[model samples]
Target: MTAKLPAPITLTGRHVRLEPLGRAHVPDLFAAGGGDEEVWRWIPTPVPRTVEEMAAVVDARLADTACEPFAVVDRASGRAIGVTCYFDASAEDELLEIGGTWYARAVWRTAVNTEAKLLLLTHAFEDLGMGRVVWKTDHLNERSQNAIQRLGASYEGTFRRSRRRPDGSWRDSVYFSMLREEWPVAKARLTERLHAGAAVPA
Candidate 1:
């Protein structure tokens, strides 16, 4: 709570636009991946079965002062495809964690995610002046861990039984981080991938 996170802002890129999340995004979001178990597999929340449920999820995030949530909009179709956020920040330490991210099944490994992260990381380091950006994912989610590493984050270790999953099972969280000093190289690599369309993000 010590960190002063930025107010919600829109970040536009060639493949996606990250706009402040709202109830208005529920429908497109629901259409994008609602009721699809795969899309919500790694998300802590249970699969939202209805637009109303999706609205509730969006509302919950809006009510959390610590979170700055964004609805990821695919530029080509002008539809919201998913959500991501910035939370768990500490201003005294000049650090923050970016978690609560999930994209529609269709856009899973496309340039959409690559461009979106490029925009977010640029803002986090250059605009917000954060010294470090962190990420945490389920220990069993190797695909996600790989994705984080692809973004140049260094694995920091794991927090055993950090939280319970939606299914009520204990979950161990794996942590990763990227310091400001490492952003330049990571940024270059991310930019190049975006320029290349990053079809599968090898």
Candidate 2:
């Protein structure tokens, strides 16, 4: 018999739902991320300028074996607000990287983002038995870098001249990681922070 593949995983958190990418999500995802030039400022690929382009990008990602993207839905509103992926996965080494994440300005710096990330990291280290979970962003993306630090991941240094951006400029990649041993304290702190933030008045 063929070895069984892991069942399609759907991770639900308090604030967000992570569903495996599918054609059904294309329209919402396009609306959520398409035509947002600011979202793509630090990334290589241009934001999808049209629905068709968004669909094509999602299709390509679904077809790739090395990476799997999920549509991040805000449970409170039942709307897809962004995308995130487990890429450069190494099952043999029990490693995975979370990247390609982008959310709308409305949700940025909100409880939803923190809860969503808490869900992803918990699943990676606790549920999937990953030894280490990695995160990376453009070196110039101080916003993202700060978010990573806020999640309690250790900064692992930068890869200088890692890749060329769409604008023909070289980009440095900053890396961060949370090891299995660090998950307990990290998760507790993240949980406390999210819960505490939720109680604050606007």
Candidate 3:
């Protein structure tokens, strides 16, 4: 497989669709996540107080070339409910990290996140032909750590005081990675979960 990064493209799944982030999503984005302290706790930026602040955050991510941000739209409601991104890409090594993800409180334990990861990992390993996909989270964030581990990423170690959080405090970053060989099982597990979701009645 050649070393190449995923281009900007929409990834559609049963539960959600990943579209390029844009200003048009501002209203739904804000409605889904804005002003929620718990939702923004692990995020690097402060909780957005208004729609404009959230739009500013979107604009900043759009301006950054190192990342490709996407609006996670729930297919059921046809509204933007979250955001995720493919960042820190290294085309030479066929490596990249999927970070910068957050969702509305309502969809926290639902099929939304599971299917989103399925779509992303599938694109990374199968479509982009990436050798590795990395994930990182604050050491103190146990929920995030468990989520990454559940996705079949091996816990790699922590970088002490890796970066400063929005609160001006040091954050230890715990890293994890899933190699190409491990994707099949992970993909299977995610697919099963999504199928289970589809089987349930509304």
Candidate 4:
């Protein structure tokens, strides 16, 4: 039997909007994702270099039931600023992996990134009733590792030489996960941080 998929989720946070990614989002997404070579350095696929390429990628993603990607829109500017996804969703195991995340440098280190993650995690754990949410990053990407740790996800060790990157180099991947038992505390902490950041004067 085919596995059941989670209903398309549209999540809006204090600083960002998460809409199901579609072809229409390509033009804006290409603009958001391009211009930053560093952001795509650790990513597996070549960064979308043009609007047509971005549209093709979004189209393929839309056709894949296993992956539910979202266009990350900055609420302040009302512009799409990045992309994220929940891939490798296993309904039978009540588990899902949140990966393929990339954001523009303009929003890096801001509350918007955290809010986007909080929205995705909340939907995965509380809304879809998932037992665990998994996160992984290239071991060489310390920034990503630190961000995941800040989310209170337990470090599950690294997979040595796990996969090859687009640059023809081996990438050891560090894995992290937050269990259902840990969700309440994690959720509360993230909620407090997001609310506090929102109240700050720009």
lDDT: which candidate is best?
3
Candidate 2 has an lDDT of 0.81
Q: Order of all candidates by lDDT, from best down to worst? A: 3, 1, 4, 2
lDDT of 4 by residue, 35-94 (tens): 467878888877778777778777877887778889998888888888899987876788
Candidate 4 off by > 4 Å: 1-4, 198-202
lDDT of candidate 2 at residue 82, scale 0 to 100: 82
TM-score of each: 0.96, 0.91, 0.94, 0.91
lDDT, candidate 2, at 197: 76
lDDT of 3 by residue, 73-153 (tens): 999999999999999788678889899999999888888888889899999899888889999999999999988888788
Best by TM-score: 1
Residue-wise lDDT of candidate 2 within 8-106, one digit each (tens)?
Answer: 578898778998878888888888778888877876776789999888878887877777788889898888888888887666788888887887766
Error of 2 at 13 (Å): 1.4
- The deviation in Å at residue 165 for candidate 1 is 0.5
Q: Write the per-residue lDDT of candidate 1 for residues 92-123, one digit (tens) a residue.
A: 78788888888888888788778888888998
Clashes of 1: 1
